[model samples]
Target: MYTQCPDCRTVFSLDASVLAHARGAVICGNCETLFDALDTLAEQLPPEPFRLLPGHTRSEEAPKLEVAIYRPREDVPVAVAEAPAAPAFTPGFVQDRRAARKLPRRWPWVVTCLSLALLLAAQVAWAKRDVLISDPTIGAWLRQACISLGCRLPLVRDVHRLHLVARDVQAHPSVPGALMISATVRNDAPFTQPYPVVSLTLSDADGHRLAMRRLHPSEYLDDAAVLRAGLAPGASAALLIEVADPGNRAVAFEFGFE
Candidate 1:
């Protein structure tokens, strides 16, 4: 027998045993529509281009039933009867209601894991700010980002990379009992660095330490702008220092950067 789904108008073929097992309720394989199999039931398909009627409606006139009568004739040869072909059954997929219900429950955990990952990255970045800022590539990227963020980075300081190229100490021509110290400091690092504190140590002919002095950037650099700009990479700065003469006892002097 054949039945058509009312919702999707899909035809399916099944036996009386299958229809009885489900009590005429069947699901459509194509549209997954649950409908009664008893409705629109047919023994054979209707003629071409003819619409199938609903279960409740019928033709105005009753369908005529034709009876077949069999008679044996000695002159006609007997033909063998062929068995009917089995009906084709299409299986329908059952929707997983539990899986659909579980889908929404997964989102909270997913969002939480993503937020934790971002938080951990932020913490690591904060803890290693100095190291990351010292890197050539990362520092350049950070500097460009800071421009748009209206933020400033502290100047890099590597005292070991600072060197005193030349230095001299002599009596001040204009000031009595005072000494004038001049030195050229260079930055050998690949990146810009802050001006270093210049330390001058004086010693006697016998190698006995006599006096010590420290000069800050503000004290040595006469230009305010240069003091704020810091020393550029591979650049040198000449600094002049005026101090009271430590006396003839101080014969030798050495400069160190800090």
Candidate 2:
């Protein structure tokens, strides 16, 4: 039997024996609320016309049985330890079956998650060994000896190893006071990729609208063989990025290896 936990909105499967043996009351596993399962089901009652006064029944007429539908109870105890005691719910509070169970605030989990994210990001950034674009420009070089997910997978792509950098930028290069971008891409995928995939996106401060591009190594880099540009295991390269107008540097540049 399937029972919905009004408190948590979770559906739990009930064992056949348990369902069969369940008494009038059923308790929610999540919120620990109790309900009278039978009290909530509507049963046919005598119809208005079918119910007659005790003395008014006429033997001449065919015997009638009352059959009517009724809305179940408007309010059922969230829990009822004893018939005379009030339920767990406060009076006048709107009760929602879905509210029977609720997730914990998760403040600790959230903090832990954010902490882990920062830690991983820090680790990635640390292991990054790439360029950091503080100005408003785009395109910079990033290199890693080799990225390992620390585990094995069917495809190497499953262990995605990529580097990314960003900043607020404009589509057309501005001059003097105008902003412009210069990018250099180098591939370090250990395995020589005849072509290294390259892409860049420029956005505003709010991370709203901007421009992006994806080009082949020949299109995105100074050298044709990106994988050849790959550092020999522990090798590194520096791609200089200078703004024409040092003031409003273009947004930022991003690089990745797969």
**Scored by CA lDDT, what does every candidate get?**
0.83, 0.43
Please give each candidate's TM-score.
Answer: 0.52, 0.25
Point out the worst 10-residue segment of candidate 2 by lDDT. Answer: 134-143
Per-residue accuracy of model 2 over 1-258 as CA lDDT, tens digit each: 344544564444554465457764678777888854333322233355532212222266786768867767777665563455655764443454345446456789989999999999878754532232111121112212123334211111211322223333343343445344444333333322233355555455666435555654454447645444443322333332323332323244454443
Q: Any runs in candidate 2 off by more than 4 Å, and if so which?
A: 1-159, 162-190, 193-195, 225-231, 237-258
Model 2 TM-score (2 dp): 0.25
lDDT of 1 by residue, 1-258 (tens): 889988778788989998999898999998999988877888888777756644745468987868858766666333423555578755443346655665678788999999999999989988887778778899889888988999877678888889889988889999999999898989987667888888988899999888888988888878888877789888999889888898989889889888
Colliding pairs, model 1: none
lDDT of 1: 0.83
